[model samples]
Every structure is written in C-alpha cells, then in structure tokens.
Target: MMLFQHHNTGIHLDSGSTFHLRTNEDDFKEGSLQGIHGGFHYASNVKGRELYQEGIDKVFDSVCKLDTRASDNVNSLSNMVQDGFDVFMDTNRENSFFVTRNGTTWRFGHHCRVPQKAED
Candidate 1:
C-alpha cells in the first residue's frame, strides 16, 4: 500500500527536520504505516511510526506552537495494537507505522496526524 505524506503544509519539526514529501495525487495513497511486515517477532513500523508521529507533533508544535502535553498517547496507542491490523517497520524499528489487515488502510494513528482535537 502506498502512504501519502502530507505536503504543501511547510511542516517543520522542532528537531529542524523539514517534512519533505511528494505524491502522484492521481495515484497517491495515505496511511499510518511503512516498511516490512515481521509478523509478531518484528514491529519496526510501530517505533518508526511513533517517531514519525512524534515528528509530526513536533512540526505542529513548531509551526503552530501548540505544545500541549498529551495525557495518554501511549495508552491510546497501546489500545490500537489490538485492532487486529498488521504493523510494519524498518529494520531498526524506528518507523514502525501501521498497516491495516486488508493492506489498504495506512496512516499514522488518526489522532497523531490529524489536526483536530475531539471535544471533551
């Protein structure tokens, strides 16, 4: 599955890494994951996904200065592991992003990349 990284946002992380990306638009797909599927023994995308998510958060924090502390990023993320989706990651487990069981739905956690906050 192809993942669409958001461009045109000029997103910059606090670590100074610019969010550089591109898409076919006509053939672009978006999701929360990347890398190889390691069954249960491997979970690379999970960590990589976290870093990607963190980078995104840093970008938002940097570009918008919305450095609000998350009360349960880990808990929410942990729960997602049970959703039965297949997760993939790089060899180093740095970008262990998520991929759906159908091999279609890809993207960072909905909460991680999405800009809107649900109402309390």
Candidate 2:
C-alpha cells in the first residue's frame, strides 16, 4: 500500500529515525489484495480457495492478539503480509526511501526507509 507522508505528525524511535507517515485512514487502505490469491502455491488447485481462507484465518487470529493499533502504527503493512503480499524495496533512489508492493508504492518519511532497520 502507498503510505503518504504526513503533513506534520512524526514518530521518533530509539534508533533516532523519525517516521512521519500520514495517519489518515484512507492513506493506507487504497490497494488491492487479489494479487495475493493469484500468487499462492495452491492458486490453481481446486482447494485453493479453502487453503487461502484457512491461511487468512490463522493470520487474522494472530493480528487480533497484537496490541498495536492501526491508528498509531504500520498495521496495514502487517495486514498486507498476512494476505500474502510481497514488498519490494525501491532501488531507483540513492537514499533509503519508499518501497512498493503489488502496484502501490509506499513513500516513507525522511527516516522511515527500511521498516525493520527503523525499528531497531
């Protein structure tokens, strides 16, 4: 999903990186997840739908147990992953920046480059 930079709000972690992503509900919700189903290993099988539903159930159950709130974090990213989305790092820029998944490019804040590294 595309994460637009917020106008002002920012989050600073212990690593000194600052994430200034837009918290607006729509910013991270405008994307399609159908690609995930198509890429699944069992997508061509007769039981593909059942397999996908089962996988989704497991992930949804896990997410429900997390304390993180969609309003305050990159919850959409997790949701995307659970649905079988694969994120691709943007390589066109010299500096660490946005990343893409499916057809959406998620732009990041000045310090919100690599999500994992930013957490550290």
Largest lDDT belongs to which candidate?
Answer: 2
lDDT of 2 by residue, 15-59 (tens): 221212222333332331222343323222133222111111111
Model 2 residue 75 lDDT score? 30
Q: Ten consecutive residues with minimal summed lDDT in candidate 2?
A: 53-62
Estimated TM-score for each candidate: 0.26, 0.26
lDDT of each: 0.28, 0.30
Task: Score candidate 1 by TM-score against the native.
Answer: 0.26
Give candidate 2 misplaced runs (Cα > 4 Å). 1-71, 76-79, 90-94, 97-102, 109-120
> What are the per-residue Cα lDDT tens digits for candidate 1 across 1-120?
334554333221111222222121211233422332332121222232212121112211211111112211211233234545454545463333544444343444323443121111
Question: CA lDDT of 119 in candidate 2?
Answer: 23
Q: What TM value does model 2 have?
A: 0.26
